[model samples]
Target: MEPLIISTRPGVRHHQLDPVGPGLTGRVFAIPLPTTPLLTDALPYVDWSDAYAVLTPLGAPCRDPQEWAEAIFQGPALWVRALFGVRELVVRLVGIEPGGGHAFATVNWRRDEVLVGTDQRHLGFRASVLVEPGRVALSTVVQVRNRRGRGYFALVRRIHPWVVRSMLARASRTMAGPS
Candidate 1:
């Protein structure tokens, strides 16, 4: 079977939420997702501020939050912007870890796009994702519907997990390295 790429309400059913760790090795979020246009599932990985402290793989001091955010967020954002026809993307983590021991987490992403020269008269699309780690290696599939069309809007669905996965690997190593 091919890696499932969920970008619709129905697509959510095609995938499963198989986390790598739990009951101590989980995530902690900084900011929470909204109450509308809910994601396929709930992501209790990040925190309320949309920030979290990840353990460096090398067991060194944790890198600056800004560093992590910069490395993690910007990379995927740029990827979507360049690789896909996306206008803007916002990624957030939604879980908690009071102590600090997490293998992976969810990246809630909200992407928007404008439909130009399409069947519709410049439609807009948006969606929320609960990205995690597992079989697909990435969770969260952003889906937008034209408030004016066949329930389908411009889309660049689920394109951040791979970026985040690869990026976090390197970032975790950097953070873990001894200073």
Candidate 2:
């Protein structure tokens, strides 16, 4: 399916994907961080943010926000998992805890959202998965603390959106089962 891309502003784009199947369509939005209370409190100053949304069928296996977060972050995407491992190792070397282990356990769960974050000398980041009736949105906000953080995220931001889109798509397909 062809994706419709719209640039809302500098460093922000909205991507709308054609539905692959009934209730299986998805979108990856590189928009500004939302001004919701939870998000604002989570990361006050956002140097970068993006959100990925996927349509969910009723009775989907991973309908809950926390479940969706686990499926997306810890699901059976071997290459993505490897990348996460490398990120963990690199961050640890810089005195940052990368929130290793089960994704669900590492995050903070609220009523309809699951939040995960880490702060270090270089940078700090917060990510959230919000579950609605028939949609799940995964959003991430990052704050660059210094020049090193700026340089590091500059490299990461190039690939971050693609990685998020891939993980969300894979998780949605896995949870949705065969068509």
Candidate 3:
């Protein structure tokens, strides 16, 4: 499989929501899998821990939906701690509810996209899939919501592209199984 790339423009599936500034968004052309199954079943199988380890020098992986909920609300503290060996304060914890064919959560209740964070920082991380005749188009969009977010974004911006790509690749490989 080829590498997934992040785009400056919103992905085709990501356009369901209007743009809010130049939020980081991108898509990957997978080997054409069913979008529904990919989201509900296959996505969870992606080796997120390993991927994060490689991508950001962090050990935290969103292993499950509940864990994802916690991680999101807590921001990148867990990953930061794993990388730096120091624990940061938990700024806030938001509630996660079922909606829009995906789990939705928010901090500061800003519009355009959904993510977890406090007033000082807001992040949007969403995953969706669009299936074509033979392959699946996987996409995600990330948005930052505060001044604190700016600093965080600056650090991750360079690697954000690879982060998405590796995540998609891991998920695809998991769906495909051992070669």
Compose the digit string of candidate 2's lDDT tens values, residues 1-179. 45455443355443434323333356444333344556657755666666667777766544566667777877747887778778878877866546556333434677788887777677877778777777777777778898878877877776677788888888777667653
Q: What is the C-alpha lDDT of each candidate?
A: 0.28, 0.66, 0.32
Clashes of each: 25, 0, 2
In candidate 1, what are the lDDT values of residues 86-175, reduced to their tens digit?
A: 222211121111211111222333332111111112222122322222101112222223242222221222333344345544444443
User: Per-residue lDDT of 1-179 in model 3, one digit per residue for the tens?
Assistant: 33333232233122212121221222232222223432333221221111111111122221333332333323333343343222122222232221231223332111222222222234444443332332223344345555655555556555544544444434433433222
Residue 120, model 3: lDDT of 22
Q: Which 10 consecutive positions of candidate 3 have the poorest summed lDDT?
A: 48-57
What would you estimate as the lDDT of candidate 3?
0.32
* Superior candidate under lDDT, 1 versus 3: 3
Q: In model 3, which runs have C-alpha deviations exceeding 4 angstroms?
A: 1-120
Better of 2 and 3 by lDDT: 2
Candidates 1 and 3, the one with greater TM-score? 3
What would the TM-scores of all predictions be? 0.32, 0.71, 0.35
